[model samples]
Target: MQHDFLKNYKHKTKESRRLYSRAVKVFPGGVSHNIRYFEPYPFFVSGAKGKQLSDVDGNKYTDYWMGHWALILGHSPKVVVNALAEQAKNGILYGTVNGVSVELAETIKKLMPRAEMMRFSSTGSEATMYAIRLARARTGRRIVAKAIGGWHGFNTALMQTVNYPFEEEEGLGLVQDEGQFVESIPFNNLDASLKVLETVKDDLACIIIEPVLGGAGCVPPIDGYLQGLEEFAKKNGSLFILDEIVTGFRLSLHGAASIYGLEPDLFTLGKIAGGGMPIGILCGDKDIMSLADPVARADKESLCAIGGGTFSANPMTMTAGLLTLNFLKENKQQVYSKIDRLGRMARKGLTKLFAESGIPCQVTGEGSMFLTHFSKNVVMDATDIANSNRELLKAYHLALMANHGIFFLPTKMAALSFAHEEGDIKKLLEATKKIIIDSKLFKRFA
Candidate 1:
């Protein structure tokens, strides 16, 4: 009666109600992001530390959402928080370049060998927007071929979800996305993609993609697909832009680009790079990135199209990014290895649960990420995911949160953080098993 999930949620906090009420008046949805929105209202966080997310209503969660997959070290890891607090005390920002920003760039370049230069923006949208812009400028092309259903920032041209076809009710006809020349294609349909590209191959400036599809249900690129994309883009005289916002850092030290041995002409980064702070980055060759720094140009004049923001590389965020990267570098083996173990544990546990229940459920994801789609079959692309058992999955999501303490990304695509341990995986698996046992939909399989 008094906002369900509060008396129900174990870590309900007070700010949830206040934030929701205060936010609705200022913002349409009371939240700036889609994933944060819920049926009645969303919980407001008082703070987070380690793997715990404390809601304004005093609800403490095990935090599988992990700040939407950015807190690689988990919640307020002392290294990042202390860096931010210390930097905040020294002062927040100025109108000039700083040391930490340079350090963060150098650290990322070391991981992504293909990246020789970089620039930081506040959000993934800006990073991606600039990436596509750079592609167009360098190639002098008009069209950008992106994988269908891939959400690249908030750019009007790239918001379409990958692996999922547009709903007819939305009235977005198939030929093109309203006005933009964004041509969408299936992730692994090599021949189909090639054939489609042939239509406007000459006009294409870039073919941007996610190495492992994060949205459209955590779909991974099929084997040889990445290579095919690279070859195809090059042969057609187009730039390949790797959108690793979600997969960056989380996938490996090299991120998705290095893990797949991808050599992209342009790269966009976000998510974990910010260390839970708002940050976005676009990087590539020295010649290309020089467009952003006018002094590096032959003309010696900067242009607005080069991408710059006032609070783009703010001090506190840069400090957090620097600290997070330092921790990631020093503990590379431990952190990556530990997160991999957690992924394996969750994947194995869920596979066992779904198999025993005779329910066609599947867990697909990589790195410190996993998406539990209610289908016991292999999902290669969007169509397979679209027909997944959403009803059962949503019910399972609610059950896991309500009956048990495990929290997940409400949209089915879940992220794992370092704070999670074997015990955390076990607890989630145990809860999921019970939810399966209690679900009539799960029983229907039997």
Candidate 2:
């Protein structure tokens, strides 16, 4: 069947147009989050099952983005659905400790050994924010060190002043975007980052890093980089905190820490721990996490300055988490093996398509999460992602959505899940190949 990329394709996303128009009246950009809004509007999803996502417009997609990389079991897994229903019947929020909450903590501690004790929150941002604060309280310092494209959350501390074009930034008399209090250093450049750490040594409380940079693309670190960081943080008297929000259970039961062979004093978990529920956890040694304990902090009237929220570890999410944790623990190895196969296939297929067109591209990922990077070569850090062809990446995402229902995160990130099979992987590869052929992006890069 003959189709149109610009003409007929635009009509298919009509519901997005209508929704965005209505959304803008109440919200700033027809969407709550900045990234959720794309082009005329975003294609809203009505439902998801296994590896498929059905948009409000009735188009079905083989989704690799996996709900922004949250659903490792994929959308509406039977186990999660049953667990959630049972938990719901019991109660949603108890506003206090419960059996399920303790269960999740114990499971996390067992899997991620460095996490001796754990606290909870409802989002990755909160977990990381509190971790940073905890590090500061432990060390009595302020400055934080992180990778260039590191995304702990959209929190101002980590999100600000990253991925900016320094050359253009100079002319604008600003760093990049609207953010404050961040010391942006180039990624994968150990010397450059070390210099920043050295300069801020005195004031630095901790160095928080994502073992495998996820949002910047699933780019792994160079040899000895994570270890060197541990050495540096130790020498400087700062704590080492690993942001495992995305990598935690998704990469492995032990996550990047175990895989990379490093031990962070404190760690965080986000994507899979909640078990399709909304929750975040910061786990670390008993001494460190105790900072949040009212008794440990002392000066009861010291303004409740530490981090603890009423709904931080509600009962329902904990119940779902327990169910998911048990399932994952029992089948962790098998799940990773299957997903890794899919990851390799999709990455290889996408590379071959780009090769045919002579497009300078690379696929970086771990386990099942993959990203199609438009660059001269494979990158080891966020700097390459910042300097690469974002416009082409955007076009690729849009084309894949149109040419075939092979959905990915609009942000050039592909977060695969356990539900994806070989067929889904093939569909995504075929769809990607079509986009490369149709867009002629290779020539544009040439």
Candidate 3:
């Protein structure tokens, strides 16, 4: 059955097969990013619009991956595209400070007031890397703590214990001493996490974590888990940082901090903030953020020394981000209400469907994102996620793509965009039901 599905995928994506053949000659694993390459090669996208992705082979699938969960308004919303076209006519990169960048910053500050000051970077990795640096500088401490399965980005310093088998070395090329000052704690287990923090409390610089764990699994933190960590950091004289790159604007306009009542000393934002363009923002209190002020410090020794790259705050990104935020701000009620409602429907429908078929599974996520864990046990952390039936989940996602026109990035989390509606959810449910009935793979899971 697995072989049959692979054959079906190959038959549908012949052009993609040819393109991937050429890609491997230049790129590692036939792709720039590791996740983009999956079993039997990934389909090359020709274009995308709204909630649909059209591949080079003319196969269209309702895009649940949603540009790594960045496109909340969906592919090419006219509001952003039209304004971006005009902005492009003026300039894309000035390589210097611009007014539009200031406007965008002001807009973000107005929306999320905790961001008294901010600096823009081209990627979330840069934002998170800088966040830790600022914490170390502020407290004059050395150690940083992160959740076991939390993924901040590819930054070398925070790369410890990101994948499964949390105790093992992440991979080659990372120096042994690089992770010396970093500590990992289990997610959702506040007592165990606090015990680990106690060991390095004196030298702890910061506690950086994702409010909702992405990449590792779409697991939401249990109640009071985040708040307890924050309280510990506060008492231990360490800065508390929230890596909201995935949960920032997606959960709500105010970000997850507001929803969870967290007052982090420093926080990072990316993904949806970019508005389908590339952007990364590090926001914090005025006093802490001012450490990066070159003019105020006057010397390299006195400053934190963090800023954006050449592409940071380019006019194109600033324009698109500003437009997207503006649209969301104006229609905030409509946008959040619709997307959250859809998220509830997806979770509930899937839970009931799986139960009826005698399949043991748990659907995990908050707001508009979700993932299925093929396990009877409750999933609360990365260890539980690692123990789940990942192979079966991958096969299920593959079947959805090959036999049905639904798209999920294999076993990764799926996010519903504002462009998706009730009809789209119905279609997805229908497809899942058909796959459950027709595929012989479900028998083993049952």
Candidate 4:
């Protein structure tokens, strides 16, 4: 079955293979982004609309990746696209302040009361980096505490313990001793998290975490885990930073912080907030955010120096974001309920399918995001995921893409957008069932 699937994949994606052959000479690993690369070669997407992605090879897939989990409203929503088109005619970038940026900021503030003051950056990584810098500057500390397997961004301070084995450094050219400044605590383990925070309390500036572990398989925190972390941070004289890059708008209109009743000292947001454009936002209390205020600072060195990129808060992204947020605000109840229902349906259906096939599986996550684990043990943290049958999970992901026409992050997580419907969910379940039966996956697991 595996061999046959490979043959079919190769035949269907011959054009993609040809493109990759050219791409390899230009980009490392034949892909601009590492995650886009997969075994054999990843198909080149020609277009995306609603929940469907059309590949260059003429195969259409039900896309669950959703622009790396950024497009909650799905691709090319009319409002966002129209706003972008209009904004493009006026100007893309002014290299100065704009009304659209102010409008977007006001909208975000209305939704997130904790964001008393906010600033923009070009990408999630920059937002997280600025948040860390602000925390350090405000608290007069250098150390940060992060959850084990939590992914904040690619920034040096928060890059440790992300998908890599605990205590193992994951990237190259990291600033020396930067890893020392980051202490990892087991996610959802209140006692262990407290102990780690206490150990580094003296120098700990903040505890940064994702309310729902994003790239580490959508593991939501155990009940009260976020609240406990916030309390611990305050008790230890450290700030609490919520990295809502993935959960800010996708989880709810107000974000995970609001849903969980978490009042972090700082919050980093990206993804869906940009309305499918490149954006990052850092928002927090006025006292903490004042460090980034250029007018208040007498000199450049006096403030934290949260520099902006040339493209940060450009008119195009601002317009798109404003339109997206306005739509979400207007239809909050309907949008949230539909996506939540879809997510629940996917989880329940997938769980039943796996069980009926005699496969050891666990479905985890909340709201519109989820992940599949090829394991019997309950997954509460990253280590549990690391210990699962990863090869089997990879095989399953490949099978889904090659045979089932479903596309998500390779064996990582799946997201449901407002564009996903009952029909799409039904197709996913049916395809999964067919894969389980035809690939003999049930027998192998048994």
* Candidate that would win on TM-score: 3
Candidate 3 lDDT, 236-351, residue by residue in tens: 99999999999988999999999999999999999888899998999998999999998999898999999799999999999989999999999999999999899889999999
Q: What is model 3's C-alpha RMSD?
A: 0.8
What are the runs in model 3 whose C-alpha is more than 4 Å off? none
Best candidate, lDDT:
3
CA displacement after TM-score superposition, residue 435 of candidate 3 (Å): 0.8
**Candidate 3 structure, TM-score to reference:** 0.99
Put down candidate 4 lDDT per residue, 1-446, tens digits, no spaces. 35566677888999999999999999999987778888778899999999989999999888999998988899999999987888788888899999889999989999999989899988999999999899999889999888889887777778888875777768678775878888999999999888778888999999889999888878998888999999988887889999999998888888898889999989999988899999999999999899888888969787888856999998888888889899999989989999999999999999999988778889998999988898889999999999888777777777788887888767778888889999988988898888887875556675
Which whole-number lDDT from 0 to 100 does residue 163 have in model 1?
34
Residue 387: error of model 3 in Å?
A: 0.9
Clashes of each: 22, 0, 0, 0
TM-scores of the models, in the order given: 0.91, 0.92, 0.99, 0.98
Candidate order by TM-score, decreasing, is: 3, 4, 2, 1
CA lDDT, candidate 1, residue 278: 89
Candidate 4 residue runs with Cα over 4 Å from true position: none
Comparison by lDDT, 1 against 3, better one: 3
What ordering of candidates by lDDT runs from best to worst?
A: 3, 4, 1, 2
- Of candidate 4, the 10-residue stretch with the lowest lDDT total is 1-10
Clashing pairs in 2: none
